[model samples]
Target: MMIQMELSMLNRNGTLVSEEETEEVTGIHCENLVIAFAVSNSPDFRSIRIIKTIKMCSHCHTFAKLVSEKYKRQILIKDPNCLHKFKGGKCSCEDYW
Candidate 1:
C-alpha cells in the first residue's frame, strides 16, 4: 500500500520524479485525487501490501521518511536488496550488511 502509493506517485504521468518532487507531490491537493484508483482506505492493508513488485527506489526512501514523520506512522518497505522499517524517528535496516 505505502510502497505502491510511493511507486504510483513516483511513476505517475509517465515521468520519474525527484525527491523534492515527491515531497511536493504529497502536498498536492486535487479533487481528482479523492477519486483515485486505490479505493481501499484500509490502513492495515496499506502497511501489509508491497505496492510495487520491485524494490523501493532511492528517491522513495526520502519520501517514505517524510511520510512517516508527517503522519506519525510506521512504513515498512521491502526491496530486492533490503528490508527497511521506518518509525520513531529512525530506520531499521534489518541486519542487512
Candidate 2:
C-alpha cells in the first residue's frame, strides 16, 4: 500500500525532472502505508497482516521492521517475491532487501 509521493520530480528551482532522475536522487519511490494502518488497527488486534501485489521496496521494508519493534507486535507482509515477518527490529529476510 505504499504510495509514491510524487509522480514526477521537481528541481530545487521547481523545474520538473524525469522519474528516473527522481529515483536516482532520492533512492525512494514509495513510503510505508502499513505503519499508519497498523497503529490505528493494532489496538484491536495482536498482529497485522499486509498483502501487496508488487515487491516491497527497501525503505518500506525497513520501516516495517522498526514499527514492529517499537510496538512489540508482529507484522506479516506478503509481496509477490517473498513473505516477510517483522519483529523486534528484525525481519525474516534479515535485511537482505
Candidate 3:
C-alpha cells in the first residue's frame, strides 16, 4: 500500500478542511501510484485494485476520476475510510470521501 501525509480532508459537513485542530492525516496519493502501476503493468491490463491504509487526498481522487475516464479503465481503491471506484470522470464517493 502507498502512503503520504495529507494536510486536509472533508468533514461531515462536506466542506474542504485541514485538521489543524489535531494533525494532518496521512494517506496514499493515487495519481502517482496509478502512474507507476501503468508503467510497470501491461497496457492490456485495464483495471487495477489498490489497497491503502489511509484515506486518499482530493487531488489524487480527482486525478483518478479523470484518468479512469481518459483511459477507459476501472480503478478500485480501498482505504480505511471507504472504497472508491473511479470511472467515466467520476468517483463512487462523489467527492465526499
Q: Residue by residue across 1-97, what tens digits does model 3's lDDT show?
A: 3333344567778888644322344454444455456635646345666666556777768777887887777888887899999878889998897
List the global CA lDDT of all models. Answer: 0.48, 0.70, 0.66
By summed lDDT, which 10 consecutive residues of candidate 1 come out lowest? 29-38
The local distance difference test score of model 2 is 0.70
Model 3 lDDT, residue 63, Cα? 76
Q: Residue-wise lDDT of candidate 2 within 2-84, one digit each (tens)?
A: 32233567899999977556656987543254456556655734667776656777778878888888888788888788889
Candidate 2, position 81, lDDT: 85
Report how far off residue 84 is in candidate 3 (Å).
0.2
Better candidate number, 1 or 2, judged by TM-score: 2
Candidate closest to the true structure, highest lDDT: 2
How do the residues 1-97 of candidate 1 rate in per-residue lDDT, one tens digit apiece?
Answer: 2323433344546787753464456754221132132223545324432333445555556555555555555666555676677665456763332
Selected candidate, larger TM-score, 1 vs 3: 3
Give the true-structure RMSD of model 3: 9.1
